[model samples]
Target: MRTTTHAAQAGGEPLDVLIVGAGLSGIGAAATLRRRCPDKRFGILEARSAIGGTWDLFRYPGIRSDSDMYTLGYAFRPWTDPQAIADGPAIRAYVADTAREYGIEPHIRFGHKVTKASWSSAEALWTVTAALAGGGERVLRTRFLYLCSGYYSYDEAYRPRFEGEAAFRGRIVHPQFWPGDLDYGGKRVVVVGSGATAVTLVPAMTERAAHVTMLQRSPSYVVSRPAQDRFARRMQRWLPQGLAYAVARWRLIAESIFLYRLARGRPALVKRHLVAQAQRQAGPGVDAAVHFSPSYKPWDQRVCLVPDGDLFQVLRTGRAEIVTDHIARFTERGILLASGRELEADLVVLATGLSLKVLGGAAIEVDGSPLDPAQAMSYKGMMLGDVPNCAMTFGYTNASWTLKADLTAGYVCRLLSWMDRRGLAIAVPRRDRAVASRPFLGFTSGYVQRASRLLPKQGARKPWQVYQNYVMDLLTIRFGRIDDGVMHFGAKGCLP
Candidate 1:
């Protein structure tokens, strides 16, 4: 492994590219940068002692990838496990392996938390301020700064303020930051939220807890399928490993796209089928109205994915129950429902959704002037309009995160190559007056909608508005010309 001191080597000061966060996105960024700019010096600053970001941080029981590993895994690297749905440890191991294989481990500086980054027009660089793990603060200057820290606030978990929350005597925990010493054996546990986290928690907790109750404000559309694809296995036996992976990836992508479109075009039909499936698993005499009815239209919010019906199996056995109601208040012993009933609980798990932040809460300043991300438009879903030589990546909410991440990475590589060949110092996206635009992230989920005002706007044309279709993204980001419209290239040493 290559190692270097904190200070630059005796060679001419390296053109530094500082990346914050050592999670999947951060590591992916490092790999992409190394492949694109072999001579540029880059460093990854991670807040935690380890890598793996979300996968490493979340260790609650039954924690795993919500999406199938076939697509969730890195694009360049194919997942070789028989089971497409994998547990947290397995995912973490894959991430660690990727870092080691790419020699990115040595580039990562553990326990370095970036507090703020300010841009300087005079130097055309970013001054980053970070707090070290042991003590004291350190400052570093970088030619370019990449914020791959993700959207969630690592320090705080989103726990809605419920009435009489302080009065609850039972142990309360947020799934985002599960305590290592927590013990739920032989206790009645109630997990709140209808998202992926809650669905994953109930079944796993029920094994040790006497009973597990999943409490939610409303229902979430849930689906289940086999953890392993029999066809994928059959093809693997006959075809090469890479060929099998390619077939499986394309097959899954097509199936998902078709199903998603069907759900969006015909909500009633999809809702009936989904509810019926849930009923089949839940069995007769259960209140499907309360347990399966969702207020919003299908695809309005992301549907939860469960592997091999594990959650439904738990419900079918009566070890776990779903209660959909308005939470009135928290009693000393448990949660009080608005229906004038108390659900007794020994342990409460808050699986509530995450609070969204832009650019992982990093402040964006250009030429000593604060830049408002909301006022800007997203160019190619990677770079913000008017932001020069800067790009940020956000993955798909419905599909595998790496699908979008990979596309963005490829596009950034192409952009960098163009700039280098032309001797350009800055590449900024310029808005075309002839075209109409919309908000970049148009999802209707409460968490995303609440923060839409802070997100960048999207263009009506291609590359500006994110193409959720993977095939289209492949053509535009991977194979299309980098000198397309809306991209403005400035000569070296040019300020604007």
Candidate 2:
């Protein structure tokens, strides 16, 4: 929205807050700041030209939100769409519309990719350096820096090389960078991986391709739900739109919490239910044990969602199939599996996973010393330990991402307000030396495990712990005290 970078307009005056990334989290953070702390001047620096971060970037066929829109949608803005499982373009438009509605567009500086943020205790400011799209550098200073750049790299997708990838004659595509003009119609397609992307692609491509085969080393949990919420629709007819939306949101949130708890508390029962559902939906020919059941328990990795049983429907129709085998290599015709079986394909889609990155790959420095997110313990799942005047929104691993992001934004606003009332310049989390550290994410997914060393560590105690539960975070972040003993606050040049 804003054509020029903030540095050009600041005129040597630092902003009250500088938010990185104009994605879902960043936009939500800006809107929250405008509503709660209107007196503070803030600017959003977006690396890309578009407003929708993930939605705008991903253009693969059948690209849709894995999570239901009721919970994924922002709390302030109620999702009025009839389809609870909305597509990428619709979600992108929703984000852009929110920005316009809140008058948050004008404060956004597009194509200003933040490279580094350095905090100075003496000045109590964060000097941010960004690379402009037009090939120039700009510097901007701010009192507080908020990062919502997301957890993964935008420039790269997790593309693993096959043993003989170069020998393959057909075109290989990564879903992250889907080619617009390429046609898969009447072609045999083999999609690699069993994650959300692969699940989405297999069903979507089956409609156009001659046949689609989902090739994976192991199976992931897949669940099916209706696209529209009948209850939500009925609620909208009776109650006010906002109230109806809130009710639906809460209902979905409660169901999620209950299901997650059930899965964790009674893994055997939950797994049996999931496998039974899959077996029934997948029809007779499909082997549920060989291709549907996952080795690990539910929630160990993200469960893939197939709206309206679209994936199973495709499988039953005989347009698509799932192959549970390891890729021995890429042959001249297709992929050769470890079972000495060869699957022929005209096109290969590698929907492996995402490559995770911390702080949008921006280097962070505190008082001229480099700050490694891996080394720093996560405080309240947002702020890093001993890191002053900064907060990053890392969403819930179990539920919808926006649930935690919204809470994080609200907490940041509360923190700023508290500091203002007390005339404080800096607020940093002080990790207790006694608290033990654990992996930031408990997910056993390939992406999470690969980026374990790149992510921040979570603490064992309260306030320092990253509880993936929404209810717990809601109480702690929204209603909790700001001057908790774990967080130390002070003025500039008088460090706490």
Local distance difference test scores for all models: 0.81, 0.92
The candidate that achieves the highest lDDT relative to the unseen native structure: 2
Give the clashing residue pairs of candidate 1, or none: 440-458
As a whole number from 0 to 100, the lDDT of residue 323 in candidate 2 is 94
**Model 2, span 351-396: residue lDDT tens:** 9999999989999999999998899999889899999989999888
For candidate 2, give the lDDT of residue 372. Answer: 86
Off by over 4 Å in 1: 1-12, 120-122, 433-437
| Model 2 residue 358 lDDT score | 94
lDDT of 1 by residue, 110-184 (tens): 877777677665566677767777775566777767778887777787778899889988999999889999999
Q: Where does the lowest 10-residue lDDT sum fall in candidate 2?
A: 1-10
Give per-model TM-scores.
0.94, 0.98
Quote the positional error of residue 141 for candidate 2 in Å: 0.3
The TM-score leader among the candidates is 2
